[model samples]
Target: MATLSPEMPKSDDRKSSKDVVAKLNYVGEMHDRAVYDIRNPAGSNIVWDTRDVTIHDVRPHLDKFTMDTQGFAFVKLPSKFAENPELFEGNRKARHFVTDDSLDVQYAQEICDYIQNMTGARDVFPRLGGLVMRTSTRASAEKAAWAPPAEFVHLDFAPQAMQGWIDKTLAAKPRDLKPYSRVQLFQAWRCISPGPQDNTLAICDGDTVSSDDKVIVDSMTGDPSIPGNRWDSRMCHYSPDHRWYYMPDMEPDDLVLFKGYDSDVPDAMNAMHSAFQNPLGQTGVPRKSIEARILAFYD
Candidate 1:
């Protein structure tokens, strides 16, 4: 059961018994764990980047990592990694996400070049024939009872943004791939709630707006009928076309290659969706309910 919110009384929670009903006029659902998007930093209501809060991932040695002025932070693997695995294991960060516009273009290009080199596609960029990303989705990955299943790992891939990136890459021509001289990228997100379509979100009610604004794919995971998060409860990532879709659950720093070019992947994703049918009977990932009582009860 959700803890009562401090914002208001239990009986006057107004929207739902599970909600706290903050003083804000909106009668939206509420729950500390009832998921929301973190794309806009305001979600946390906490200022500063990841460093502002020292909850987890605090550093004993700041010198071992690199954080430039643009807020692009990452650590390169040294040649001595194989020779000294114990010391070099912890300081590495895989994805140096370009979170700020004012960052230097050279830094982004440098990181991209490093990624290309690591992918074993040495000359694909800088004067490239082209770049291609083939994608595939594995449905019901949670059903398998593997001893090391992916319940704990971050669900880092969102489907909508992934499609957006796919569209972006396909439109570009085989231009001379100079180091990105004008590094500009548009960011947007849609707060998708699961509905009739598979993996696609329906606008809450009467909303019709979309743009380069950051999107919040408010995803639901695990079995939908169940009240709480199950083994598969998670949020995924979607990018237009980035070097690493996501690293595997292997080592802390081992960036695994995702198969982004397979044509049959999208069809497989639709087959498992819980539409029309009730989620209680669904065998795999549960569907979020739209019933007035079920939907708005949890924020």
Candidate 2:
């Protein structure tokens, strides 16, 4: 990691020692006793209702970890999608699919191209990534396409799940893909809401995370029509070496690019992240964001 001090220093507004409660998944031994249940499967809200869990007051030691050294980076994009905030509204589902002709879809494709350029990948394939809104208010929250801030520190894909997704996605496409030795998965996330967030994301530096720190868990999407099974994801335990950081007061224009999975790099494939409560956050405003997952192919 390069020297984080010369770049920027902690301020009174963004304190260094500040700690917030972060709910994380249980360690391996406790998993045997943990409960696994789908709460609102019909409503697309499925999670582990495990009683055995760890809720820790974690302090984001940002001075140590950063994007260049870690598996995450920040991008400044004064996007066209931010202009019309009402584009995503009044949807019961968690995500609304973007059409090919829609302006939102066009903006999303721009992000895909940005990732491809950054990674120097031959081709980038985009999934149906859409709007995700979160609010503290009951009425507005109920009507909107909402997802609670992910409490657990986890990666979106495990080995098997990623391979399955690749196989399934490629099989559906009409043309045969060119031979590629490496595949990388990335997520481009941006907060489309107006102000500062109370529940913000915290990312762990990939270099510090060890192999034994991760535990794979099944992500049940609640769609029973599909043949065999749910997606596989990873959950993590607290490690002394784990270095965490967060971008304070993120706005509509700011974008965060992070790694979900990378086949070429084994030691630091998935960048572990979760939304943590900000102790110094403003009142009333909730977090509303959009995230797109893209697959990058390298020959």
Candidate 3:
């Protein structure tokens, strides 16, 4: 059962004066637990029923949220690809289908370097296998091998799942490697398509999220018979106190970094995010974006 924070302000009190309204899907009440089986060829079987609740934008109060405080921060750091698209041919080829070999290694390294510089971590590892490209346009979604925008409000990984990844990663390194005092998982997201996105990504403030608001679900892919085909993810139960925000007219140069998990900080804010319909309607091209998962180690 998700509990609302008594100290938090009511939803109505924090409503944006701009009248931006959209529906966000959240885990609905269920007697049995939920599971996401992507192995189903016909279509993914999402046993976790969801309810779409009307939510208002919090852009007017953007100043209230910060990377350290709310676990997400938006920036306008332009990518090299954005400046010189012709220089990275692999990035262009990725529009069709993204694979470890298809994505440019240089591009991935650049992002890793950017994250390292921004967070000042001793080391940063990019999960190349976790790189994903998503689109919202119907034509593009069908033609491209990429996935559509995710509509559910949820966190990417549960604590145990993240810990398992960390353990596995550390185990693969040399025995003589120095031990890190802290580790953080983050997702760096950016728009790849045109501006004025019709379906934008919205993030929930971590401070407003109660620990009880999360439900763990089995996130499965590929063959169910395979041992490594499953991992745990978190789904959120709707709460009135959850504050959501989104950048209105994001460009390809814009980037947002949000925390997924942090070691040595049990109560650290973990940004929960989802894609929602832009209530203002489609002003430009349908949203197409890329996201990269990164792990930062601090000694």
**lDDT string, candidate 3, 15-68, tens digits:** 435335678777777556567654343544444445444444544565566666
> Which candidate number maximizes lDDT?
3
Per-residue error at 290 for model 3, in Å?
Answer: 0.3
| Steric overlap count per candidate | 19, 0, 0
TM values, all candidates: 0.23, 0.76, 0.78
Off by over 4 Å in 1: 1-35, 39-103, 122-153, 168-299
lDDT of 1 at 228: 22
Tens digit of per-residue lDDT, candidate 2, span 21-131: 444433444434222223344543224322222222222443344544577765566677654646555222544555657656666677777777666778887653354
The TM-score of predicted model 2 comes to 0.76
Q: Give me the displacement of residue 285 in model 1, in angstroms.
A: 40
Write down the worst ten-residue block by lDDT for model 3: 1-10
**Overall lDDT per candidate, in order of appearance:** 0.20, 0.60, 0.65
Candidate 3 similarity to native, TM-score: 0.78
Candidate 3 residue 199 C-alpha distance from true site, Å: 1.6
Answer with 1 or 2, whichever has the higher lDDT.
2
Off by over 4 Å in 2: 1-28, 31-69, 90-97, 128-143, 171-176, 227-229, 266-269, 282-284
